[model samples]
Target: MAKRVLVKFSGEALAGEEGYGIDTQILNYIAGEIKSLIDAGIQVGVVVGGGNIVRGVTAAADGIITRTSGDYMGMLATVINGVAIQEALEHIGVETRLQTAIDMQEIGEAFIVRRARRHLEKGRVVVFAGGTGNPYFTTDTAATLRASEIGADMLIKATKVDGVYDKDPKKYPDAIKLDTISYDKALEDHIKVMDDTAIAQAKDNKLPIVVCNMFEKGNLLKIINGDTSLCSVVK
Candidate 1:
């Protein structure tokens, strides 16, 4: 089993059924899942996307907002999410550290690689926010970057679906869920396992990416325990 891993949760998932804003119920559920990883004696780092509140691309679509500004807004959105999850994780008796890529001394510490790794070593869940502190980068890329920097064995992409499929399973009922996929194959086939940038980074770092459903209780643990039937592995 991988001792250390980074898990990425989409901001949209936080909205749950309502489809906007952070849903406390979903937030608490995610926290509980992270706690399961911690209890399993594995070090966990978390990255949550900001799409529920705002998306850089969508905000910039009208052409009034510059891409740079929109991306920054998205980064800030991720920070808000980071704070929420950090709090939820702590409320359940899980030790956590909220660190942001952008300097936010008021609520969290600045992102520091050594400090983050130290927290993981000490068994605290380090929540990474602020999206690489750069514009034009998605939280997916940020997740891969953080996973690589912390020397994590794998990066987990938590989604609504069970695993990566040939096509959108919601649209195509016969879509085949991949059991395992290679980095190059995923890139060439245009699989939506993650964005191209994120996949390339994981490929460079040789970090395995596990795609699994976040809402399903025990799914994270099951995938980490090498239950390939439950999720897809992108390496």
Candidate 2:
């Protein structure tokens, strides 16, 4: 059996057509991929971002509230996404666990690394949310933290683009994509793939990260099946 993996999905990926909220079609497709992985005997965990609902820095920049408070709200938003994803997974007959960094007794249990590992051991897909329960830390940092804690073999960051690029691929038609990159180079180039804190944490923990576009069919499974050329790997 392959090692357990932590997959991180961004909020934008959840936006199927209208560019916001949980898209049922996309959710079902993601759930199917996760189910296929589980069927193949690969342990899976997820860390989901809440940007589709509300963004902390953006809200604060709009003078809606203080940065810290807005970020907390963003964290709450993640719980909502987590719940939605959990439901999607369970609806497809996949066992799952939703662990949150913040304490919301009504929604799910608080994050405990040991408990998460135990769940993974039992073959249940664990969904990690709430962004470390701290302000100013992106969900990317939370994914790295959870992946490190769970001893995941790989940190799979599912994004809109296929892989890391010198510039925003959506905006720059001529942006160059890197198939394999060193963490040091990613930092030097100030790549928008992840925050410095997240990349640093992954590097410090010696965890390999695979960045791929989740929109592609079976892309997640392909990456785990040793298709290194399909995505960008950071070591």
Candidate 3:
């Protein structure tokens, strides 16, 4: 198992079947999964996206709001998700901390690299909300940034799909699932495993990323246990 890792949870995954808003069952399941990792002696940090509430880029494309404002709104949405997850974890008796890039002192602590590392070392799951506290950046980038800052052994992106594919599996009947792929190959092929900026950042930092399906029971634990068959490892 990895000694330390960062997991990126897409907001959409938290929404479950309803397609919007947090689902109690899904939140509890995810919290349970994180607790399992913690119990196994793996230090875990999380960066969550706000796409379920509002995708900044998508909202901006609709032309009602500027991209900057939309992004900030999205960041706030992440904090909401962070808080919800924190509550779920704590309710299940897992010690967790919510840290935001943008200050929201009443609820969460400001994001500090040292403080976050300390929390992880003390066995607290640190949830990073607010995507880089900036516009024009996806949460994927934020996840990579946090993973690099915390010196994580690996970045695990929890998605709805089982693994990275040559094409969208839902759209392509014969899309091949890649067990392993180079950063350059993933970027060159325009694979949607992650945004280009995130892939580039991970590549530059020599950080390996595992893309896996969060909905699959015991998958995260299996991935941490070095079960490569359950996910795609990108180096």
Candidate 4:
């Protein structure tokens, strides 16, 4: 089977120490990581969240802007991030394509499943943005949706932590890391690996979910090479 994978990145991963905006260093690092995957003959797709810019739920919390408008704004934020990643990847000589769920002719091509598949087949990394082009839907759900559409072998949720833990490792000193977890257990125990909807979708599709530390260099390569020590696999 082809080693096609979808990477779901949280918006905060792109942020700086202050956790407020895009960090070029982080972007470059992630680009390099993606480049390594491509060089290793893996087709990659990316879906990034907009929390670093603005979260729709937070925006609508004050009840000033409606949830619908806030969600749309969040979608646009993802586009900004998508284009940024595209530029970063291209700067490092990785062929890339930016496709948005919503039509934005000047910025990116409108998302088409066939086009995305073609891009992947040609060894181009496809950056999926605009969050399913629907209100009240999150980037997590968008990642799963795109992963299923692309027939990806796995969905990787790269985070600061190395793997899934029985509890919040930060708050609980005794938190135990799980090398492998079931989708049902992750959802039942609220593992926080991915959103509930995203996890459920992965379960339905029987797609394996790998959680690894994004900051760790070579972790992606290691995990893909069957290094179980580096990640937690949810299946």
The TM-score values for the models, in the order shown, are 0.98, 0.96, 0.98, 0.97
The C-alpha lDDT values of all candidates are 0.94, 0.90, 0.94, 0.93
Cα lDDT, model 2, residue 143 = 95
Model 4 over residues 199-220: C-alpha lDDT tens digits? 9999999989999999999888
Positional deviation of 77 in candidate 4, in angstroms?
Answer: 0.6
lDDT of 2 by residue, 1-235 (tens): 2479999999878887788898889889899989989988888999999988998998899786999999998999899999999999999899999999999878898899899999998989999989999999999999999999999999999987788887887788999888888989877776787888899999999988899988788988888989977799889
Per-residue lDDT, model 1, residue 128, is: 97
Residues 56-105 of candidate 1: C-alpha lDDT, one tens digit per residue = 99999999999999999999999999999999999999999999999989
What TM value does model 1 have?
A: 0.98
Better of 2 and 3 by lDDT: 3
Write candidate 3's Cα lDDT for 78-196 as tens digits.
99999999999999998999999998899999999999999999999999998899999999999999999999999999988989988778999999999999999988986786999
Which of candidates 1 and 4 reaches a greater TM-score? 1
Model 4 earns a TM-score of 0.97
Candidate 2 clash pair list: none
Error of 1 at 130 (Å): 0.2
Candidate 1 C-alpha RMSD relative to the actual structure: 0.8
Off by over 4 Å in 3: none
What does candidate 2 score on TM? 0.96
